[model samples]
Target: MTSAPQLLTDPFLQLPTATSVQVVWFTEFAGVNHIVTYGENLKQTARASTTKLSRTREDQQSRVASQNQDGQVYQKPVQRDIWRHEAEVTGLTPGVRVNYRVTSVQEDGKSVDSDVFSLAATPKSDTPLKILLTSDHQLKPMTAANLQKVVETVGRVDGVWFAGDLVNVSDRASEWFDDNGGGALFPGLQGRAKHEMTHNGVKTIYTGGQIIQHAPMFTCIGNHEVMGRFARTGSLNDEFDDTIPRVVAQRIYPDKSLIDNSFNTNTYEEIFSLPKSKEGEKRYYAVSFGDTRLVVLYATNMWRTPKLDGKFKGRYREAEKDLNNPENWGYGQVIYEPIAKGSKQYNWLESELNSPEFQQAKYKVVMFHHPPHTLGDNIVPAYTEPVQIIERDSDNIKAVRYEYPKDADYIIRDVVPILEAANVQLVFYGHSHLWNRFVSPSGMHFLETSNVGNTYGAAWGDRKREVPIGYQEDYVKLGDPNGLEPIVPTIAPLLGEDGKPMPYIASNDITVFSIFDTGTGTVSSYRFDTRKPDSEVLKFDEFKLKLSSLPLPPGNKFPG
Candidate 1:
């Protein structure tokens, strides 16, 4: 007998507040009713039913056309509905553990009850808050083990701030749902799934200690969340990476009716219900908890390279091609929203940074996907058009190097100054999947510890030190070609007490995560070395930030 549709994952928490919190889960059954009962004890009392959001596909002709052996063309609509349910429980006391149970009725009329789970509401001011910071865990082999370590080390955390790239492909249901290969993401986070990973010829099964069951998770959108495709098949096939099958791919996903068409974060917007400002919830938002105020920005551009090869790279729209549409033509296009000067996100960010709540908070941290001072290859801007500064091919094979322009892009020229002026404590970002830290001359701390699932290699080596043999070809550098290189942290291999360099750990294979403890004012980084069979998670680095005490800047005060 076939199994009827039922609740497939545990009720996970999101968007925690002093007085309320949201619980979300997925089910195999569509249109089935579900409810969450939460209260002061494990026995539960308060109740809230879920609001069902169903899936919808585009019109039939939208699917890509294909030919059969008989020379006839056909298309199939590959749409399947997976139910996502959410319940926002309110009026709970802050900083108190609340018990909850998720009950669901399957399509077959069978009732199911989830294991009793508990979560505390977000803490108010003066309460100790410990947060786990991580990002770019796209269902890799080490993902389960890395998260398992978070629970092993920090025990219980108030919240998790994922700095983007939750999955490699946002629209792929299997990636978020069940990957038959035994890597269902939700089950893994809930501690019900395990993935077997082999490194350096040693094999192991990795599992996470059910984390989301208690701690809430907040995320930013990365380039992977924004997909590009012309036909409906692009949405169906997880492997399709080119721009839409036709000319316009950005705004054509659901339909061609909207104007913001370069790329869309549709799947991301639907999956998570985050806190919002007047600008809505999908892109930019702010949340205040305990003594800290976090400002999350959607500051990344689409994934296009400096050189647009027809085979593997993105191209200009047919109408915007060089020959046919000079009026709308451009080459080496870098598609992204303008977040500097007079852009919507910029204005919203400025207002938020200057607000009284932000200025008065003991800690101010800004998070986004792209890093302003990363040594990774993705840090290069594809276009310097209006600015006239561009990147050129360097002597190293597969490596492209460029000098910082007199007038930088909006992020550096605009955003950084505002953040420094506002006295933002730290900036957390991920895209370069490695752990590296840099402090500007002005004492601003920029930390990238994305080595969660894996790494994209490191931006190691400088002119003085021969580039690490493995990273030489891809090593990127900044500063005048003939002058002293900037004093930035070098990506060097760790050393053993014997005074010899340890064996290299390839970038895409490292596992790491970081934590911030407000009460102790310290950030601790822990890493798991797969090479050691009985290896224990080791604390690799620790740093402390001086809490801000100065009054708000002259014009940054928000009215009561």
Candidate 2:
């Protein structure tokens, strides 16, 4: 049998024109580089043509895992999010059909390639589009049933909305050991004729690349990819010391710089080579498919800075001048810097919103990392409190460190308004790491899809958290429907002013999973406990998207 190509570039296809599609792949022509070939599949059989460029230093994340057997901890090689060498092909007419693959050069001067995949360009939508949406796919190959779930998704839907968090951190532990040749193509089946049994009693399979290669995906960044670097204490303005900007914690000891860095999804980036952002660069941007317009925002950057307006940010530092406080001087300063709206990104976003291109789109959906709405009654009680400082563009207010204007300022002041005025219909965020959806008073949908990897609890809204501390519309809990009494909420306890149980409410399985159609006007929620593959849907039919009938054009984007 012919051996696989050494290294293959991802993102097998691109749409340059309405009908033309470009196919990209990798080959070891000079070094690890990309080769793209295209033609009208409609004209005779398309012939393969090629181009080659070395894999940028960051492109080669392929490595074998190794470990020390002292019962201490095993270490594995870091995985680049995607395959190497992506082809950005275009010049196709819209609504045309095409097929492609990734041809990669391996370390042995040989090459590897992905299975052939195909897609039909965006045909002018005659009806509201139906995009299959699912997120938080935390698959562990250790079990048999879990592996089945991966197989189950193949050919099941039109296209997939793969929100982030694709692997288990511990899953790569095998990289530290070698049951196979050198790498981790398959965790347990190294030389076996077939992969018939499960590993560690859990089902496992390598399906990520397979799914991505075939599906013309509308992907969203998830918290798991950046959860380690997420500092919820404040905002992205919070500073860190990594000049190189690491994505995932390369070595694992909770490196501080990993705070805003990550590469988990980078593997997907390499394999798929999706569209990238102009300023922040790839991973956070919009993707349009036919009638769908997906606005991808970067939320991890939002909740990084700690809440410290001009007066108090340095207050703790100044007090530590003598260095004898026992409690570190930086204790309350919030590790990152104080954020302001006057920065360049704010202006760029405002301009993007004002663009006729953005406004003309029928459906506008925005995706990022942090939740704009508070899910529980315990934390801030309400979503709005003056947390961020707004001195330039507009809006001004002040309060406690985490209050709306001070810490929460970015979401409300810099981002949300632009989306709202620009006619964006839905927003999706994941930093909180659970399934949640909050509808704003302004008739927009706020959806959060996290927990693809790990999970925590979610707090329900409490009337008290809203009155005393809430300032934003999302934080202010609206009354529950007549028959939909809320499941009790829970929040971690801290000494209350009165020293009582804070009584915050949070739910664990309130995860967001369901079939949603912009045309149907509703998202019926379902909870699947992946722990036991076929476990009954935990909360059977408890929540339903309260779709507002306010008429809008059919959307081509997803509310990430």
Candidate 3:
């Protein structure tokens, strides 16, 4: 007989708060449902449940499961399931004691609740700026040790940050049990699990939703979020618009109508919506907490336009000039369209950085997906770079040189200069699937973390002084044994995109940053790992970004 869904956790991912705090809980029986009760410690606390609330992004689900001839198929259902959930309790006053609980909910309206948990809020005046970080942890997604470390760290820090590629693209229960949700997940993720399986020794991962929602999350879109590099080559297509993510989509089975709801940039704006917008812009704006101001950019989606103007003029000019050269054309791509800085986003980014309001901020923090540096990998953009810039993009792209490991460039063209000029404090990102930090000769700090879940095979420990040695090549030919490189098929299907496969390629996870308001105007960084057993953590670096009033570097090096 199958046991009903049930909560399978205790003190599962809880953290203290200065103001508003997000709470998370886990379950293994099947789906997860959270009903938090909080108020005057151990006294009267208001109650709220996950089922009653709603999300803007309307996620999508495939009508039917894909057929696999390989032996990987499970004898039972494997696609849909959501074993975790996170909820933000907004309008929370600072520095108060609050108690809470998470519940596991079922399809027939059955539910299992969590054991009680509590936290003492830090005084609003003295916000605890904390950061939990990790990089390149693919094969061991949510390893038991890693999960335990995460749980231990959250209780102390005020925020979290994810580097990139958190998990490997595997639909097997083993992988799902490890990573929260490997990249873009689809529907049916919630309905696949049953409570009785645990007794039979089912190793279900009760992560995902709870890890992110429990804290004010800042997401940096990574190559994984864009799928993989195979997407750039129209030849292969597998786009997963299911932002809830595959590992996550199967579990957090909410109402079907919410699929694709504000998913793209729209959904990002809502979940991560800050205290204010860029004057009248959408979600892309600068936020100020105490003395810290954060500027977020979407490298894959915008600001990469190849129009000829300001910063982009040079890149576009080079592409245009190389477009016709036969030998050189091999290295250039005229189809993806070089997104120049003179284009739409470039112009917007300029105004955002140059505005007096932006310049006035004390501590400027910038975030994006993709690493600016990596291990012993050589590429044209790798060597000879300045730290004054906070640019981000997919460098060392996949299937090119062994693979195109996206480095930091798109931001270099536009954001770096602007940030340097604004005396930005530091830069945070995840893409190379590694944990690395570089202090530019100019005293600016740059960090690349993303080992939260999966790193595939990308890991650089002590090889800090390494660079890409050769140029990466793409788009060779069909059946050409020398086709330069191979392509990876998209493992997860997107929600809004309903085509042969997901247009985006690669299988990775996006990074997130939690901006904490530490008194004295000093901000530190902490990265969070959301796997199981929750005891893993990357080296958490603490620093006071000394923003220089230095003029923009000569020749548009650092724009702001």
Candidate whose TM-score is highest:
1
What's the residue-level lDDT of 341 in candidate 1? 66
Tens-digit lDDT string for candidate 2 (1-560): 85554432244334333554445443434444334333444333333444322111110121222323322222222222322343444554555556655444445556555545565555454334444445444332221222223324323223445554432221232221222222222221111111232334875332222333333555555433322233222212121211112312444425544533422233334434456668645555565655556666544331222223333233112122323321212222121211135544555555555554465555666665445554532223222223332222233222222333233456665577656656666775554445545555566666554443334444432333223233342434443211122222122222335665432222332223444454544443444444444455332222233332333333433231
Q: Which regions of candidate 3 deviate over 4 angstroms?
A: 7-34, 41-91, 104-109, 118-128, 134-147, 150-155, 168-214, 228-286, 289-291, 300-340, 354-361, 373-409, 450-544, 547-560
RMSD, model 2, all Cα superposed? 11.1
TM-score per candidate, chains pooled? 0.80, 0.57, 0.52
Candidate order by TM-score, highest to lowest? 1, 2, 3
Tens-digit lDDT track of model 3 for 191-266: 2222110213434443222333233334444433332111122111122211222222223335432333212232
Per residue, candidate 1 scores C-alpha lDDT tens digits across 164-212 of 8887666556566655444546666677666777767888776666888
Output the lDDT of residue 215, model 1.
84
Q: What is the lDDT of residue 144 in candidate 2?
A: 22
Q: Which residue pairs clash within candidate 1?
A: 229-244, 230-244, 230-245, 455-508
Range of the 10 consecutive residues with the lowest summed lDDT in candidate 1: 463-472
Backbone clashes counted, model 2:
105
